[model samples]
Target: MSGRRLAELLAATETQTPQGGQAVSFEPLGWVWLKAGSRRRRERTEAGVTRMIETMRVETRADPRLVAGRVLRFDGDDWTVVAVEVDAERPGRVRADLERRP
Candidate 1:
């Protein structure tokens, strides 16, 4: 897949209790093909709440696993999906807005 990158969609695949506490494990749904996206820094102000957000715009084939609040592993980092939008120009494709998790 030229002009594309690969990322693992992270999900709460399993759960368990350790020491009477709850814990979860995020497992990879599978390797997915992603169109080349960029790492960007954005500054926004809403209701006087200004913040700098590091974001990524990932374009890929429409996958049911690409849901908001889900995590994606790529480039050795985890990114949280902020939003998903349809790719009007490329039907069957979608653009996922992601924010880097610290």
Candidate 2:
């Protein structure tokens, strides 16, 4: 089967903007293309109880404002930026791990 390049993969994702308002403290940054990479789930047992933590891994264009501890609104939900890296997989893009925030 034929394979696709990194630029092609990044181009496939749709562009979106962060809901810049009182919800976010800083000024609006550049547009980001969100690509749903994967979902991670971890189970921890503590005090005879098991807790499940879920997070989502997404890829987007490198943006300075998209950093850890920032809450971003997209797809009708708010997701907190757990971690972010520049060109971890390829150049000109960023990989971010997010956790759904209620």
Cα RMSD to the true fold for all candidates: 4.2, 9.9
Where in model 1 is the C-alpha error above 4 Å? 1-3, 13-24, 43-52
What value does the lDDT take at residue 59 in candidate 2?
A: 75
- Number of backbone clashes in candidate 2: 0
If scored against the real structure, what TM-score would every candidate get?
0.72, 0.56
Q: Which lDDT tens digits does candidate 2 get at residues 4-37?
A: 2132111112334476433324333434657775
Error of 2 at 15 (Å): 32
Question: Cα lDDT of all candidates, in order?
Answer: 0.80, 0.61
Residue pairs clashing in model 1 are none
On lDDT, the candidate that comes out on top is 1
Candidate 2 TM-score to native: 0.56
Model 2: clashing residue pairs? Answer: none
